[model samples]
Target: MAPPAWTTRPNAKDDLRERARELRRQHRSVPEVAAELGIAKSTAYRWVRDIPLDVDARKALFAREHSSTTGHGQMMAEARWSEYRAERDARQAERVTGAAGSVGGLTQEELVRIGAMMYWCEGAKAKPWNSTRRITFVNSDAGLILVFLAFLRAVGVEQSTIDFRVQIHETADADAAVRWWAAKVGADRTIFRRTSLKRHNPKTVRYNTGADYHGCLIVSVRRSRAIYDMVEGLVIGVVRAAGRPSAPCDPWPQ
Candidate 1:
């Protein structure tokens, strides 16, 4: 005689019931067990409701609930994230390309304004207590350093007037860094000053110790007092033009 209909059904299948119980011990939800085993959710619950989840299963369940990721759900989560990142990257690239196209080229006046703004943010400033006027621009970004050099050239600073120095950790390849800066600046190595070596602290973890790490280039303009006041004036002008009615250039009018 053939097996009864109830015995043939998935809910009543011994193998699926055993599998459902195993998944339940792993903290699989009733819906998940039902969908996976091709059984009704009520049946799945009835089969494994008494199986208590262990600590690992509880943690896995928590991870799955919080981020849609964990033991069994990790592959699905990764696929979803990969798809999301690709879409986001495409959108960002399109917008950035359009915006970059809108900027035709930098004019002399625009370069001056931009250079002054850049200096105001990165260059050293004079204080009343120190009163030493110097033009020292330091940066680790090669592009920014090149732009600053171009700005100096635009402001009538000769290549001979600029001095370059590499400040780096003692563990870094100082000679290689010097060569890199020299090539980037297109200046003779003779013009470069002594490299400053920073003592490496063993206890601290460093992320900048790779082959691409060239440390920082310090550009000190010799006899720069002439253009110091001009940069200051430009920064002051920008600060004062924030709203209607310009204020006097006096930084401390109190």
Candidate 2:
């Protein structure tokens, strides 16, 4: 039999065309066949355009194209979301700053009330089952710690009687944290009890890492038996004053 038409061509074009067609028949994509054969995609497609893909081949092509397009679209969406988040965060910050400005210096009574409420939420309390008045507060927030100190001062609690130490994971920079806490709370290193080191857990994924992580400060006022009762009274007063009218209780004792 006479050789097929393409074998008589003077150059490799005939071989490339046949190879491109063979790849297309084997379900290879136009770009893949063009790349292997060193031909333009358009030229590859022109050669293989008449080759019909079966249902599975069409589905595979669709999946590949969809995956590429979806990936590109997702990246664009993430970029837009990042921009939106920054703008939203900035606007929220402005509102927060404005709201903060509305609050001027707190009065002694206000501090007492605020501190009592704050302590009730985060501080150790004496339960009815086992009653012992011990005033202890632990927190990681610097602002709360500072406010609590102010509250103690307003209530006439001497600073000397207060005991403080940091509680942190053993993996953290314990020395740096101690120094940071000393400067932050205006306390001497000599005063703080030995820091409480938590044993590290290999299974845990900890997010509270980095230079800013100073660990939680544990503050306990020695000889606080009386102060505990006073705080309890202050918290009760606030509850009575702010209590809703629905509950049948004697109108807060005058």
lDDT of 2 by residue, 40-109 (tens): 8899999999997899998877676557656843564578799999999999999999999999988899
Return the top candidate by lDDT: 2
Q: Tell me, by TM-score, which candidate is best.
A: 1
Instruction: For candidate 2, give the lDDT.
Output: 0.88
Error of 1 at 223 (Å): 0.9
RMSD to native for every prediction? 8.9, 13.1
Off by over 4 Å in 2: 1-71, 244-254
lDDT of 1 by residue, 1-254 (tens): 88888776665478888999988877887778998999999999899989877788878666775564344566665777999999999999999999989999999887887888888799888999988788999899989999888889889998878889999999999999999999998887777899999999999999998899999999999899877888999988887685434554445565
Worst 10 residues of 2 by lDDT: 68-77
Off-target runs (Cα >4 Å) in candidate 1 are 1-60, 63-71, 245-254
Q: State in Å the error of residue 188, model 2.
A: 1.0
Model 1 clash tally? 0
Assess each prediction's global lDDT (C-alpha) against the native. Answer: 0.86, 0.88
